[model samples]
Target: MLKTLGFAIICLLLFGRCAQQVSPTGGKKDSIPPNLIQSIPLNKTLNFKENRVELFFDEYVVVDNITQKLVITPEADNPYSYRLNGTSIVLNFKKQFQDSTTYTLNFGDAIKDFAERNPAKNLKLVFSTGSSLDSGRVYGMVKDVQTNKPLFDALVGLYNPTDTLNPAKQKPFYFSRTDSSGVFSIENVQTRNYTMIAIDDKNRNMLFNAKDERIGFLSKPISAGVDSVSYNILMALSDNTPLKVQRTLPKVNNYTVVFSKPIEKVKVTFMNKDSLPYMIENGEQIKFFNVQPHSDTTLVKLSVTDSLETSTEFDQKIAFQAPRGKERQKDQFTISSRPENNRPLANSFSYRLIFNKPVQTIEDSKIELITDSLTHETLKNFKSTWNETHNELTIEGKSFAKDTIKWEIPKGSVISVEGDTLARTLIKHPVLNEEDFGILRGKVIGADTSKLYKHFIIELMDDQYKVIDRQYSSPYNFIHIPQGKYFLRLILDLNDNKRWDTGQVNKGIQPEPIIYLPEKTLIKSNFELNDINITLPKAP
Candidate 1:
């Protein structure tokens, strides 16, 4: 008390009259919250009759977003309104005070200064209209159940089963939002057995009607007594609603259908062997293409099944018609390079040319290397390979010369299916030296490629948990790591999709297993750390 009072005195001395003017820093930031100078009706007053109240502070104070941070309980039909008067808050109650009951005004982090804006801490002022004030108090924390991480600003409420009801429709008897650490408390609560609820109110309507709103609750009623009752609530996203077709868009030879949630097992049927666009199971979108429109219109159906195969949800067959009017311009087939243009390349590196459309021809005789507008060295012998889709072109050579070499593709050297010639282009490739990289070689033990789980991923991450590289092969070896400290995480690829799958609560399945190796490794120039085996963590 003395230290805060002294700080107030210093603040007053630094800037006069509530410090409305700017004050120079005293080489230290004022972390002390706004100190209460005085209050009307005083705190803990028994048989208090005054309805109007005023709280004076040592500095200019402002309260913003009071509806979210302020709570008055047991609640009144009409809320109190307040105004900032210089360094004071003058509050006028709208309803008459109840007799023999304790009323609490919890000012949670809403009151701050005009300058530094340092908030006043959890300030609760309690008073009684009758003989004595209620002594009961309740405190607890709220968090996400799956991630086990703290959630701040979550609404925590206590309700009497007899008098109060759904928090979705009305306010509870007492409520408060979680602090920065996910902790909340309501002091001077009435002594009673009450049902508790916590909600991540997304819309700030003080309700839980939205589909994305999270809900948590105490398993049973909490009985408040003279001492505080502490409890915790784990929030979870409700999955009671079944997946339904949210919308569908039909185009030429394709149907873009989206569901409310991710569906693992889905069956799509149509006359044409339509191809759904590649989307992870976690995404809600899927597209069907590679179709031949025999008629002007078509109908397609999509059915989704749950993991247990107990029930199947189906979407109404959507009808699509051929588009009318002018045709859209076709996208020109373009070429892109790898060990990319103007990039440093090693002598033994393989070059690649990726085309948006399949290339009809690559005139090998017209491709050559150049330097300073003069003809340069050419590949003595090279191996070329193309994918089945003809969209990729890979060229492997024996070795590249040391000079900063230039590659040239003469006009008409390459042609697309439309018979359009590729414009001549040039690229510069510089040889990469030895100091640019380090090697990472490690081993992953206890991997089983059985029916249940076929593959595991060993990922190298920086200190921030961002994955730098991931290897799915045995022995878990990675080369050419930049100089830095790295951590390792092993993921049990349950579905052999080569990615960790998130849990689906409705389907009753947990996420794919992931084990983070406990140790961090540092790699330097020309360093090789071998025999490091990272074992999977045992599930609890």
Candidate 2:
């Protein structure tokens, strides 16, 4: 009797310890995914007619992002309602199934363990209403035309155009997104003549709305036979109508006018057809300078006249106006000075004044130049020359050892183009030291000796990969560098437009290719790094 009671007590203690719950403390993280134990009607069931499915898991599971993860082919009118039953998932379909068809549901990363959120691998279920399943498939790749870079998760679809229908107007019969390598495939498509299209679908709607969507399509509908068809798509945007004025922006000294597409030339005039002073910032951006101040709002008309023909460019003429206060609207022309505190006059340099508008006059009497030498005497002889636009003044002078030049422009000494008085300012700049700067010279090697190597651009990038200097690539490349890590990149200029251009879809233009060097160049202080070679690869 004593032995029996002891054994019963020991069993009770052991069972109690085994049944107790444990808090997640220090241990190896749960890396194992959930396991599917069984499913209703079995997986890949032929002639399946059930409206509901129950999936049993080995451990407790949760269904999250059901809409995004669960992709159903031949989609029903409504969505599936999911229910959690401990270690099981109950999916009830609200829509009826189609007749004589194979329906597939891919639970993509949705079935995850409740505790660790580790998902089951490739959870898919398929059923056929008929005797067999459709084996027709479509596979292809998607890439950016200009960069030749893969576009992952881009949508590729097929539409059956039984009627005269536009591919962008309706949803596709079958669709799939590209994988990490920009590859896409759709199965069970039902062999037929289909209009194929690929799009960067931003709205998640299967249809293509051209306003913001990039599209790639075939010239004619493709016939999908029993065999899988391979189609490669190059994603690009359709070019907008040319010569249309997009918008106008008013800055402190200039009005920036933008166009819908690149134009060779543009003409700006007042309502009275007077020629306006303008600068071409780019093929699209035009800057009109020295706009006269008006007491009230003024109307400025812009016209774009291309070589082919002149259409009514902008939908409406851009308007211009000046400020209504005694103060001028333009921001003050400020002078920034940098002086080399150590090793002064190490290199010959220029003292400059960058003005926003053309300077009407400069009072040389009020200008004083003093050097931070022992004597600290003011200099009288100096020459100033303005740039072509008259907006910049470069002071030509001689350099001295251990001397820091101080330039002082007194108040009301300089006049703006608007006849407004300028304020007093002083500036000082440091000369470059050979010891502080490094010289980098290298031979561009490993270039493909093909005819396609002509118009490539060699770009010197900083540590952050920002362009520090750009030059036409040469056999021997040279540039002065400050002590920092740098890299080189080569861009193939196909259009000879002086820059990399993105391709147009409707125009069938491909984007320029770029070759980025993997090796990094480190420029150290007081060191001239020479014989550094850079090799460029073939264009993609």
**Best-fitting candidate, scored by lDDT:** 1
lDDT of 1 at 511: 50
lDDT tens digits, residue span 1-540, model 1: 999999999998877755565656578776777888898878887888767988889988888787667767777666678888979998888766888888888776788987678988767788998887777878988877544457999988887764335566766787778988999887787888887878898776677653677777764578887886578877766543567778877765445677776565566555454423222123465554423333343344556754323245464544444556575233464778886788876666678887755566777767876544554555334678886446577888644465566778778888865456777877787766557667777676655434444578888888766777888966877666778888877777867776665444334344555666666788777777787787654434
Q: Candidate 2: misplaced stretches above 4 Å?
A: 1-33, 40-54, 73-86, 90-104, 109-112, 116-122, 126-267, 271-299, 303-312, 315-331, 334-415, 421-430, 435-453, 483-485, 521-540
Q: Judge candidate 1 against the unseen true structure and give its global Cα lDDT, from 0 to 1.
A: 0.69
Over 4 Å off in model 1, which ranges? 1-33, 39-54, 71-78, 83-87, 90-105, 114-118, 126-267, 271-292, 303-328, 332-435, 442-457, 472-475, 491-498, 504-521, 531-539
**Cα lDDT computed for each candidate against the true fold:** 0.69, 0.68
Clash count (model 1, backbone only)? 0
Residue pairs with clashing backbones, model 1 = none
Candidate 2 lDDT (Cα, 0 to 1): 0.68
Worst 10 residues of 2 by lDDT: 338-347
